[model samples]
Target: DAGVTQSPTHLIKTRGQQVTLRCSPKSGHDTVSWYQQALGQGPQFIFQYYEEEERQRGNFPDRFSGHQFPNYSSELNVNALLLGDSALYLCASTAGGKGHAPAKNIQYFGAGTRLSVL
Candidate 1:
C-alpha cells in the first residue's frame, strides 16, 4: 500500500561525476516519470517510462538517462554531471497503458532525491 519511493534522499558530487537515483512505483502502477526541480522553480519533466521502455522525453541533454524494470521500479542515471544539475530529482508513478483514460493517470510522487554538484 505504499506510494512511490525514492532512495539516497541526499547526495553530493563534483562536476563530471555520475549519479544514479532509484524509485519504486506504487502498487499496480506500471509507468514512471522523472522530474528535476530547482530552487523556486517548478518541476521540469525529464522523461517517462512504460513497459520497460522510454515513452517520452523532455529537452534534457543526453547526460540524462533512465530505465524501467519489469516490477515497475525505475532508475534515473545522470552522467557528466554539471553544476546546473543540482536540484531535487523527483519520481512519480501512475497507472498507465492502453484503456486508461488520460485523466486517470494521476501521478503519485516520492519524497525525492536531492543532488548537489559542485
Candidate 2:
C-alpha cells in the first residue's frame, strides 16, 4: 500500500543548469504523469507514460522530458532551465488495471519536488 514517493523534497538551481527529479509509483500502479504547478496556479500536465512509452503530452516545450523504468519508477529531466521553471514538480500515478475515474481518473500526487531556479 505504498504511495508515490519523490526525492530531494526540495531543490535549487541556477538559471541555466539542469536538474533531475525522481518518482516511484504506488504499489500495483503502472502509469506515471508529471505536472508543474506555479506559485498560484493549478497543476499543469506535462506528460504521461505507460508501458515505458509516452502516452500523452501537454503543451510544454522540448526542454522537458522524462523516462519510466521497468520498475514503474520515473525521472523528470529539465535542461537549460529557465528562471520561470522554478515551481513544484509533481508525480502522479494511477493503476492501469483499475477502471478510469469518471473525471479521467484521479491523479494521486506526491508532496512534489520543489525546484528553485535562480
Best prediction by lDDT: 1
* Candidate 1: tens digits of C-alpha lDDT, residues 41-102: 99999999999999999999999999999999999999999999999999999888634577
RMSD of 2: 1.6
lDDT of 2 by residue, 1-118 (tens): 8899999899999988999999999887889999999999999999998989889999999999999999989999999999999999999998864767653466788999999999
TM-score of each: 0.96, 0.93
- Candidate 1, clashing residue pairs? none
For all candidates in order, the CA lDDT equals 0.95, 0.92
Worst 10 residues of 2 by lDDT: 96-105
Worst 10 residues of 1 by lDDT: 96-105
In candidate 1, clashing pairs total 0
